[model samples]
Target: DGYLATFDLDEYRAVKGGVAKKLYRYTNKRLWKRHRFTIGLRSLAEEKLGFKQGQFESELARSLAAPVAELQRFGIVCVIKQHGRMKQVHIAKKMKRKEAKEPSAPVPSLAKKLLDRGVDNAVELVQRFDAERIRDQIENFDDRTKNGNDVGPGWLRCAVENGYGFRKGFKPSRIVAEEQKVKSEKRRKAVADRAREDAELKTQQAADEEAFAEFLKFRNSLSENRRQELEDEALSKCSEFERNCVVKARRNDEIGMFHQLLWEQYIIPTLAED
Candidate 1:
């Protein structure tokens, strides 16, 4: 019978004094919907029989027949939704049963018997069933890919959410390593580019400093009177042109010195460390 049931783990724990620990227990509603029938049946069994679905023996099923039938007759459905370590079962129909016999205990109640076995049995069953099914689905995934069917993004996302694709194989670690390699390569390239730019600027600065030193040396070698005579002669050779060129050259030297001092005080130490 088609029915929907939502089972909440917290509520289950409050009743049973034990928690659901399977990875699949925390899966979202949409993923659980893939096995909606199984989930609903399990929830109903828990609710009506005070036994987890996996513990639903033939006798337990028989015990719950009346309640199941009543819901079925009323056209009400049960939906089960599981979150991590929690299960919730939503019943759509209201059965006309007396308050006294209306499943007096909470589903999977923490009576002595349930306390002894319920938690361990429920967790084991869920883990075993879910792991086997996930393994089969992964093995068959290649067939879908070969047929040009992309497993929708949602499918992959669900697998990741449920922790199915990794830990089983070394694939997740491999992917992480590859991503790290790419980032490392990008960082190296950026550092190289910056270094090249710094080298070019340094080379230009050194050339300017060397030329200025040579000019100063020549000027110092001459007597003051001889240097003045040479300046007057150069000015006389080309009046406006010489004056303009000399003025501009002096201005450039002043600007270059300012930049050189700034680099030495701030930029050079940082670049050298890198």
Candidate 2:
């Protein structure tokens, strides 16, 4: 038994950004037996790479650079070359020298599942098809194949070919789309909630500012004697320690500080009631 590591549809789909999918498809279709493939840059752009018409060679090369680098991370190497008026790309898979090894520890989960269903070439089948799709087919086969029905690998293969899971009114793509929609709705709701909270905070802040301004105006309109009486009433409500602090401020000739202390102790509370 030997383990072979290859990227399945899940890993391929998980790769994000910059024409990686196109690059993968192109390389995958062409580089199965051969290690290298050469294609016209213009043809690759228009056909496989999905670039728009009239794109210059420099632009295509620049765009291809990123995906080429990305594919390199997945063991594919690319070389771009210009020959007179023709620009071509060489796509190659990096090969490692094979050496003798010990027996594989255990079959992978997907292969094991295939084996349980009586597939002699479970490992080959796992490598050949999308793992998730295979798993889906296996589940569908299990559900449909009852005690009397055929529960063999042949039935499973037929189920996979016909896409029994999709035929049962549920598709993997549809599920993914629905999940994305739910996530998008949650994000939108979160943003709306944040905006509403911010607006409410600002409105309350404006109302508090207006009320404080009115309080200041009403106090200024009061006669000097009346204002002094109100200040004394406010000071009476203060604790002994607070009153001592106010006295110390007044003794230091800090008139602004003394007024602020009185406003906090008395005027602000009266304004709050109004």
Candidate 3:
């Protein structure tokens, strides 16, 4: 892997260090900055970590400046983003806890083998490996099993459960799509229901209009004396229930309103005014 190093001193000393000697392409510092030579892997080992380490590392460097300057080894983790969502997914095992004295959490680091996969924008994580594959490699150890030292998957779980990890929001596209789908379905069902009710109402109205017209024609055809005789005959054939309904509707009500269900098929004639 190509290496460009940095140090804390009167100024800062950043030069080729560690595995940079292994490659002829990395023989000079000039080649290290070139995009072609830079395509190869970089190291994430504490001794070999570069400025390109992610936001998590940057936060760590800022938070634990004292411990780092003391050359105290510590663990670190990073949060990444992919596809417009934040993913606080740990990749490999780093030093674990930021401070030597702190409990070891199940913090995965970007391994030296996967250094090139690291990105400066923690929001855009390198997708070279999936979370499941990386997660499978983590092993959680019990406190006492490792002699009261927090290490492994168990520590990671504890750390995350205690609020050390990142949580992401719903994907914007997915949420919008689902909301639109629900609205469309509701609109479709409402339209269908309204149409059905309108059709039924129109059919009933048409039937009522036809019945009223038929009754008017029948009444017009009969002379007043004949209509009265016919009405008397019909009333005599009616039940006590029908008689009572007619009495209740004696004023300002349609003649058809007093008809029994069985008599409804035939329209009732309206009597001519005296």
Write the residue-wise lDDT of candidate 1 on 1-274 in tens digits.
Answer: 1222454332222221122222123322333334333344455456533465566345444544454443332223444456555444544433322221213344332122212322223222233445444343343333344566545322432332244343333343335577899999999999999999999999998998896576566556768786556554544544475456654655675434433333344334544676
TM-score quality measure for candidate 2: 0.35
Best by lDDT: 2
> Measured by TM-score, how close is model 1 to the native structure?
0.26
- As a TM-score, model 3 comes out at 0.34
State which candidate has the highest TM-score: 2
TM-score of each: 0.26, 0.35, 0.34
Model 3, 142-212: lDDT tens digits are 22224553333323333222223222322234345779999999999999999999999999999987877
Clash pairs, model 2 backbone: none
Candidates 2 and 3, the one with greater TM-score: 2
Per residue, candidate 2 scores C-alpha lDDT tens digits across 1-274 of 2112333353364345758878886786677667898999889988887899898989999988888877775568889999889899988987732432222667788778876766555665677778777877776666556434434554565455445544454445546677999999999999999999999999998997776676567667889798777777777987777677777765885545456657766777796898
lDDT of candidate 2 vs native?
Answer: 0.70
